[model samples]
Target: MIGLKPPAIDRIALLAAHCDDIAIGAGGSLLTLCSARPGLRVDALVLSGGGTEREEEEHAALTAFCPGADLRLTVLKMPDGRLPANWDEAKAAVEDLRARTDPDLLFAPHPGDAHQDHRGLAKLVPTAFRDHQVLGYEIVKWDGDLGRPSAYQPLTPEVAEAKVALLQQHYPSQRQRPWYDREAFLGLARIRGIECHSRYAEAFHTNKLTLDLAGG
Candidate 1:
């Protein structure tokens, strides 16, 4: 498989419907990016889980995920599983984030995601940020909605292990879930890696992209 390296990504934006969504989806990639570029700016926005223990977990988890980077995270108070009801509020939050950062790359939940909140936020992303490379990250869930992804971020074995370790260490509130274990996390990574001919990887689906083969 061929690979395309993005331009120097000094700034990135992460959008998720819940606290651990970003980390669960792209934690390994974040580790690779931050480790390569110290002080990289990461702006993260979550639609729910504010004013709760989940928010605390998200802050700690993102700090570890974006080590040595400038990480700014906002977790709103939208009720979980009710994003369709709070459409305007969510759109405003996404618009505010767009106004603040012109990121080189954006990580967001895929529109085809099984969760309604994820799908709702995915729909809003393109409305605010019209011109940007948006990678739609996938989350493993009981809904069984995983699809064929077009982009792959290969992770080294050490990085993959570290990603799992950090996730387990940081998100104690999520430990109660039957699917939130190392096996589930690494299992999905392993499958994605096979698709990309790597030992471990995080995959993404992009609805649109404009490649520049002829450099300016």
Candidate 2:
């Protein structure tokens, strides 16, 4: 596979329908990015889990995931699994985030995600940040919504293991879920790594991209 290095990414935005969604989808990438760029600005928005223990979990999880970065996270009070019904509120929150930061890149749920909440947020992303590059991260779930992703961020074995360990460590609230085991997370990463010629990797899908082959 031909490789393409991303331009200088000093800042990034992360959007999610629920609290753990960002960590589950792109925790390894966050680890790699923040480590490479010390004090990188990471602005995160979550539609639900505010004013609850889940929000606390999200805060701690993301801080661990993004080490030594300027991490600012917002967890809204929107109802979980009800984003479609609250379209206006969701759109406004996304717009509010766009107005706050002109990030170099964005990580959001994909349009084809089976969950209505994920799909709703995905649709709202482009409406606000039209010019930014958005990488749609995937969360492995029982819905079987995982698709062939075109972009891959290969992870070192240490980072891969650290991702799983951190997930288990910080999110005590999610430990009850059957699919929330280390095996499930590692298994998906292993498969993605195979596709990208790495020992471990996090994959993402993108709807549009503008190439600068001339190095302008």
For 52-100, candidate 1 gives per-residue lDDT tens digits of 9999999999999999999999999999999999999999999999999
> Each candidate: what lDDT?
0.96, 0.96
Question: What TM-score should be assigned to candidate 2?
Answer: 0.99
RMSD of 2: 0.6
Superposing all C-alpha atoms, what RMSD in Å does each candidate have to the true structure?
A: 0.7, 0.6
Error of 2 at 177 (Å): 0.6
lDDT of 2: 0.96
Q: How far off is residue 97 in model 1, in Å?
A: 0.4
lDDT (tens digit, per residue) of candidate 2 on 129-210:
9999999999999999999999999999999999999999989999999999999999999999999999999999998999
